[model samples]
Target: MFKDLLKTHLFPTSWCPGCGIGGIMAQLAMAMDEMGLNQSNSVVVGGIGCTGRMAGYFNLDSVYTLHGRTLPVAQGIKMVNPSLKVIIISGDGDLASIGGNHLIHALRRNVDLAVLCNNNEVYGLTGGQAGPTTPQGTPTVSSPDGSPYEPLNLQGLLKTGSRYFYARTTVYHQVHLKRCIKEAIQWPGFAFVDIASQCIENNGRRLGFKTGYEMLAMFRDKYKRAPDGVESLAPLEIGLVKRGEEQP
Candidate 1:
């Protein structure tokens, strides 16, 4: 449905073969298409990382902000003109490590922004180093003996403030991913979508998966929709945050 919106000349992207970043980027375009949003009034702000390159690829008003500063730039744009739809696309290291403090304040204020966090668990662009979202004990170039620290529970942190929308999805579930993106865009307050994308060259190989497809299969096998209908089991909840008005 979102055919012409992309800059086709950039086809065959620079992302490593089988990297889930490409699929998540495509679904992002599809979600905008579903929401009837176009480059005319939509703005995309990205931080330094593999995901940050999305700004250069999409045919929209884009701003390539400094590392960990994507949310501040987005918030500025929203403040200047509330009419524009501001979207942030960045990675775990950029958003959670370098820009974590900004993320916390943005959620606390409930800024009108659509944020997509591509969590590949490792710093893919920088030699596959362990990142903020890297699971405990994950062997990486930086953690030869396995990481000793726990990863940040992003969903739990977001739940501390009740006004915004939050959901988590994997690139394996393209349909659900696109749907979540669409809903996040339509929401009035700040919206966050934690996308578990795979870096075949980086994370997959280290995790014993030869290719990103195998990682996708692993996700499909490991995750399922929860019985409550509002949550899913991907080792964490992957669904919309329910408000008090919807409570039984």
Candidate 2:
């Protein structure tokens, strides 16, 4: 019965074949189930783009906010109904670009909500443009000559503003992803889980990867590990480079 609630008719989604977004949705639903959060107590907030469509699929209350404004909308929901468990789902461009301010401010205020950032490294829904997290030298429709700028370190940036529980996971690591979401949901203050999803049709093809699963596998091979100091290695590193602090 609990699992049935997580199923969404949105299957055979618009996302490209093997897109990691579906895996992310599954993990989130599983986490909610494990935490015993039902539709009555849960509310999903989302911004524009493929990630934003998650609001339509979730069985719980949802608000499909304007582009890059999910966090602010989520804040309002939490403020009015403190008992509701709010989860904000957004894409890379939505969260780290136009909505960047809202993302950081939400962390500063330490609002009681969970953030699930699907970092696909490109603006998938918008004709495959180079997004804020696009790595250097990655070719995109906007960057025909390859993007020159460095990618934003999402986990590190989030750690600088708030003291909330933070974790970074990938669709490849299903167990870790599920565990991270569960932990973030349980944390009292604002919690964030940056999911390294794959835009197979956009970023993947540009990088010579055939499918989203391949991209997820690459992330697992390269950056799969917990941050240092904790008994368990976090999915990715957190915190900024302090003046005298040792780098993780």
lDDT of 1 by residue, 107-159 (tens): 88888889999988999998899998999999999998887799988877777
Model 1 misplaced regions, further than 4 Å = 227-237, 244-248
Clashes of each: 0, 3
lDDT of 2 by residue, 1-248 (tens): 44555545656666778788888888888888878888789988989999988777888778889999999999988999999999888898999999999988987887878888898889999889999998888899999998899987676666675264567777888888888787778777778787888889877888899877688778778774644455233435431111211211
Which pairs clash in model 2? 226-233, 226-234, 227-234
Report lDDT (CA) for all predictions.
0.84, 0.79
Model 2 ranges with Cα > 4 A deviation: 227-248
**Candidate 1 clashing pairs?**
none
Candidate 2 lDDT for residue 147: 86
Instruction: Give the lDDT of residue 47 in candidate 1.
Output: 94
